[model samples]
Target chain A: MSQELIDAITDMREEDAVAITKKLLDGGASPVAVLDACREAMGIIGMRFETGESFMPELILAGEILAQISAVVKPRMQQGGEDKKLGKIVLGTVQGDIHDIAKDIVGFMLDINGFEVTDLGVDVAPEKFVETVKSTGAKIVGLSGFLTLAFDPMKHTVEALKAAGLTDVKVMIGGGQIDENIRQYTGADAYGKDAMAAVAIAKSWA
Target chain B: MFIRPDNWNQMSPLERRQARLDSWQNAPTPPFVSPEAEKNYRERISRVRKIYDMAPHDRPVADLFMGANEYIVRRKGFVGKDVIYNHAALREPTLEFHREFQPDVSVGAMPYPGKPWDMLDFKTYIWGGQKLPDNLAIQAVEGEYMLASEYKEFAADPTAFWMKKYLPRAYGALGPMAMLPDFPRISESVDTIDLLVPFGLPPFQEMLKKMMEAGNELMRILGEVGQTGAMVVSEGFPGMGFNIVKTPFDYLGDTLRGTKGILMDMYRHPKDLLAATEAYVPVLVNSIVGASDRTNAPCAMYVLHKGADGFMSQAQFEKFYWPTWKQVMLALYEEGITCYLFIEGSYNTRLEYLAEMPEKSLVCHFDKSDMKRVKELLSDKFIIAGNVAASLMSTGTTDQVRAACAELVELFDGKSYIMTHGCYFENTTDDKIRAFIDSVRK
Candidate 1:
């Protein structure tokens, strides 16, 4: 039954997954089992995305279906005292760059993977980053930008974090043009090529 | 510093160009006003012409490979925020920067509607922090502008479907267009103008006035900036502002059917997707040919988006992408204009298909493709431009930039190659720019 649920999610049968997830839970199937199946399906989706067998729409759909499935299962899990928080992380598109789709994708991926994400949205300032870190206690900071001009703001944000004595916070940058060269230029601790890499970076920091 | 010719300020742009063209065509006694400057200009032109013709003249020729944009504006010490939002303000500073660079070829900016900030959709326009920073390219936030069921309607009458079904859904301002009643016979009679009395009403009048003002502003900006481009050429730089076309699949995928929506359509409505793609071919061909003829430009720029290696499978590309794009290029070639294919992402697997193109008919400017493999395959048949590491130009030292350019020149030497960036980038230093030109020279 759980395998069927996994297949439905991985195959992008959104309606089927939603219906099947409800049926399984109502039939007294484990909420934890249903959630596990969803996570397993996300792994397959992420791998396919990385392999180029899938594209943006598939990733987005998977995120949506999972969110729907999570909505149904989260209450059950909470009632049973089964929720596990991975870690808190703050994510945002850096200043001067309004591109947030990539950042949104990364955030969605992290949330499903059991991270407590505080999304700062797009065009976040350095002060905002520092403040968010202070408030949320998010140890992992994911800064996103898709333009070349994003390098300086990224660098400044990193410098600001260090200046505010948040040097222990792990800062990672991701976007269209980001690479090791940009990572070094921006003073980021590391950089990711895609959402999966962002998840991996957060996990490694944790 | 560039010294303007006599009465330069007095001459209109056309007269100035005609005078310069006359001088170039005639090659009067002494070649130029100053002997040394004449020799230098002649040498540069000769070198560029040799590369353009693929003749046995120069070993490696470097033409300037950038557009005048906020990148150059910021490099010239102006804040991008202040100038990029105002089209009229962009003219002088960008032109002055171009005068300073004085590249072998002047590649001018294509006029997009409104100011840079104003061109974007409202949500992204604000969320993206209004002043466009250098590295950012304009992207529409992904959404389904057309639903899956709308494909049949779209295929039935694309124009009406776009106006009635798509435009309202995509843009908030055009939301009222959805309420417009169909006028099947409005154009059939001259009395329809009088029948359409509501169009002259207050609300409609205000909207019409706003549109007219916007249109007038766009024209003024185009004229002023386009004049700057002509002036660049008049000052002895061969101008290149080729018209770029998107493949129909990309067009549908990008603008109408959102990426996810299109991907769904690919599975659910494969035939509709194919039909829409086929329908777009003539539209693309006509636009390319029409623009080329109108502008008298030699090359048309065909930017291949969403057809990259990983974007779709080889089979999907062969079916959905290559056929129409191939048709567009062949059709353009038939019209005496070759296309410069700015291959945006890795196209390694698709090179075999592209190689089937008519020899010397396309220039491939690679961005993410493996440069060595590209040379091994297509360098013999096509005029290859680049895959220069833009990240290096922005971050690496001049020596690193020179070393990379030297490597590319070595592979592409005299083989109809113009050393250029694989793609445009931000924060590239003047020294690195010089290194690219110098490496090609030496």
Candidate 2:
């Protein structure tokens, strides 16, 4: 199981849906088995990160590798609907900025840590976030952005959520270019300073 | 349009003094290196520019730059109020692990800011370079550093000039002093660190820790290295890092989005970028300058080739660079900190821009820039530092090191400047460093 996981990590060319499915089938890994392996390997990568043994580039690369492997194992996991729901969270980068380094990490972190994360990707305007929250009734909204201009849309998104009567849903944010003053000003429920903290905070909030 | 308070001239004396105190209290600080060990730290760092006496009066400037640390020392009145510490940048610090360490010296521009210095440092890293996939600002160009000085000059601008004329003008309204939401500053610094460490799980904690240790030794060496130029804002600390950082525009130029993102947005929406930059300048500058009380700005751009002046072909730099630098610097000048920039890489491409930078601005260090010309254009008003290339330390003999120092000495023609390397020092023979210092001081 470990060897397969390592192979998947090393062989990262298979992105998108097809490669993920093919690889999982080829490795004869079940959904539960795949999740365990990915969790274990990602934990190692996380340790490396905590010890300063890793940089952003490496952490990103590992996450990309895990994502590809997960794509391969998704179908098998569906066969076992008995797994814990762990709650659901919707994530996206704020509007007007398309950078995704922080968003990607947040998504990967939530996934690896057993959260049902619905990542909406980058440059997502506030309307999309409100719509996602309403449609999914997600209790946690994780927003990310690289530009300070995002502060407005973020505030508007929260306000929109309140307007939509989803005030109880916790809202969190993280990114490289964000600062503390933004959190206090934005009125975000919490600020996840980085990817790991984003996951930890998300879980705690959930 | 934040017009001046209409009640000007009607202020009580106490309110006026408090305003002065608040402004003074919020100044940013530069990096710290132990001045006692300046000589040694000088060898590790590439160059030292002594343009102006940073200690304007008899007051030690370094102490003023590391403002918070000194504030801590002074508020405690550990030594006594009248007892001015002679160059106290490298104060003793105790880390999470019960270890008390006296970090090496640092050189900064701020003297006594109230908070920690991360706001200035992280913001610079994000916006200092030329590599964002998109320029995010209307003024962004393909290549060059982002020193937002013009942000300091926004009060004079009109409303249209502010909203319609700036790039990322919205940011101009946000910062340490901004009445905007708290998401910007707080989310970027420790909040990001707090998240990345646990959530993102970075891999460089140990390396960063070691780098931090190594970074200190470098400070110690520069601490006592006999300075020849007037200390500008770098009161006593040297950490403002001889002021250079890789242009992020360079990041985009080489990446997939290339110039399509913010670069296009700049030419397509030039007026907006300019206006936004104008509005953002003061708050950003205040946040930047007041973030730390350093003697100079914190920067380092030529790290890839270690302050390469001759390394990059001119055409490659011009085509893939130049324009972004012009915009970022123009913005920095709009703020008042343009006077504190020190160009680390090739100045050949933009000598005029370098010259046109705020008067007393250019601190030409670690490049093959024309020695006589830099002197002719800037030395009187600007603070030129060093052209002592690191190659001299390793590749040359002792006599050669002496000769290089002599040549640099002669080139400035006895104008004020600091004697040091063209790049960072590594695997260096202590003797070589000794010889370079020995020759220059004489």
Candidate 3:
């Protein structure tokens, strides 16, 4: 049954995925089992994306399917104490950049891969990232931007984290134009070319 | 000038393309400031033509992909808003940049006329000084202007879709356009009364007034700018971009369906998405051909978005993105207009499909694609330009910029290539741009 759920989600049968999730929950399958199936399906989709068998639309649609499944399963699951999330990470699209699609993808990947992501959303100031890190005790920080204008802000964000005495925080930068040179210029700890890379970086840091 | 023969429709695509190219080359030369200027202009045009013809030429022509926007800012200390709001202020600086840089092609004074946009309450883009800092470039705000279920209606009548659905959603002040009657439904005289009713309404009247006011403001800005292409041409530089056309896929993704919305449409309504994009081919073809004819510059710029490597798989791109866009390009090629495609993102996986375009039909300006691979696959077939990282231009040292430029020129061996930055020169420094242009000149 779980394999069936995974296949349905991986195949991008949106309505079928939702229906199968409900069916599993009703057929004495645990909510945790349903959630596990979702993670497995996402891993398959992410692998396909990395292999070029899939693209952004597949990732996006898979994320949407996961969200729908989570909505169906969240109420049936127990409350809070059994938490086994990998680690905490704060993410944003950096200052002066309003692009959120890539950032949101990174956030979704991190969430599915077991990290607790605090998405600060677009146009986030450096201080906001610093304060979020300080308050949440997240050692991982992801700064996203799709423009060259985001370069200075990324450097500033990295500097701001250090200035706030959060020097041990791991900063990863990615977007449309970012690469190794930009990683060095921004003083980020690492550069991720895509959302899966972001998840891997966060996992390694965690 | 080569007029279309009566048998134009009966001719093969290649024959029609040659006729159009002949028309373009035979168009009368613009008035020049001096004989020396005319001589320089002819030399530049000849060099470009040689590269396009896949023949040996003087040297690799160097042109700015998005023009000298950042150079003007750095040299003149003008903020982004100043460039948009003060149109006349750019004439001297633009001319000065052209004189100093001396690129083979000139993209002169790309002014946005913020006043008109502001007057119209344009919702599509947030320009400098409006929402962002005065120094930053304009950024588009994505929205789902066309809903997923509306694709059938859109494909049925794209003009009505624009007037009744798209325009009102794109322009905040044009909300009354939603009340417009479908013109195709009102063929008879008796049906004319209903069509006229919406125009009589106060809201529709108010929208028309606002549109006229915005139009007038745009005209005023244009008057100040004063035919930038002609002005530049008189000084010995031929212009490259006559007009702009978006790929049908991009027309859907960028304007109507937002990126997320379109991606979903690919799954939920693949047939509708394909139909809608196909519907846009004739619209785009006619618009670009008309613009090219009017400007007498036989080139149209297509900044491709939503069809890059990571955006979709090669199969999806072939199915939904490339076919209709190829139709548009082929239609333009028949009309004698060349397509200048600035392949905005990395097109590593999509290069083979691009190479499938008709020889001499395109000039691919790449951004992040691996140029070595691009040269191997595309250099023999098309006029390829670019892959200088915009990050390197903005943040790297002058020496670094020079090294990157030298590397690309050496790779292309100075043949069938145009030296240019990978993307727009926004946020780049004056010294780096100088290094970029001067490195090639040497």
Indicate which candidate wins on DockQ: 3
> Residues B1-442, candidate 2, lDDT per residue (tens digit)?
1112356367653333233223332334343234643443343222222223221221101111211222223322232211111223323211110111122224221222111112122122222122222322211222222223332233344232333333222232222122212233456555655434432333334334444554564454345222311232133323333233334233322221223232332333345434443443344335443432243333222222211232223443443344444445444433333333334444554555466555543345544456777777767655566655443443446776677777767676556565545433222343454554455443
lDDT of 2: 0.46
Clashing pairs in 3: none
In order, candidate lDDTs are 0.71, 0.46, 0.84
Model 2 residue B1 lDDT score? 11
**Considering only chain B, what TM-score does candidate 3 achieve?**
0.93
Candidate 1 residue spans exceeding 4 A from truth: A50-52, A74-80, A83-86, A111-114, B1-68, B81-100, B107-144, B163-205, B260-271, B315-320
**Model 1, residue pairs in steric clash:** A98-B128, A147-B135, A147-B136, A148-B135, A149-B135
Tell the DockQ for candidate 2: 0.01
Please, what are the lDDT tens digits per residue for candidate 1 over residues B16-41?
A: 33343333333322223345444555
Name the weakest run of 10 consecutive residues (lDDT summed) in model 3 chain B: B65-74
lDDT, residue B137, model 2: 20
Docking class of 3: medium
lDDT of 3 at B124: 89
Please report, as a residue range, the 10-residue window in candidate 1 chain B with the lowest summed lDDT: B120-129
Report residue B186 deviation for candidate 3 (angstroms): 3.3
**Which CAPRI category fits model 2?**
incorrect
Q: Model 3 residue A89 lDDT?
A: 97
The prediction achieving the highest lDDT against the true structure is 3
Q: Cα deviation of B30 in candidate 1 (Å)? A: 21
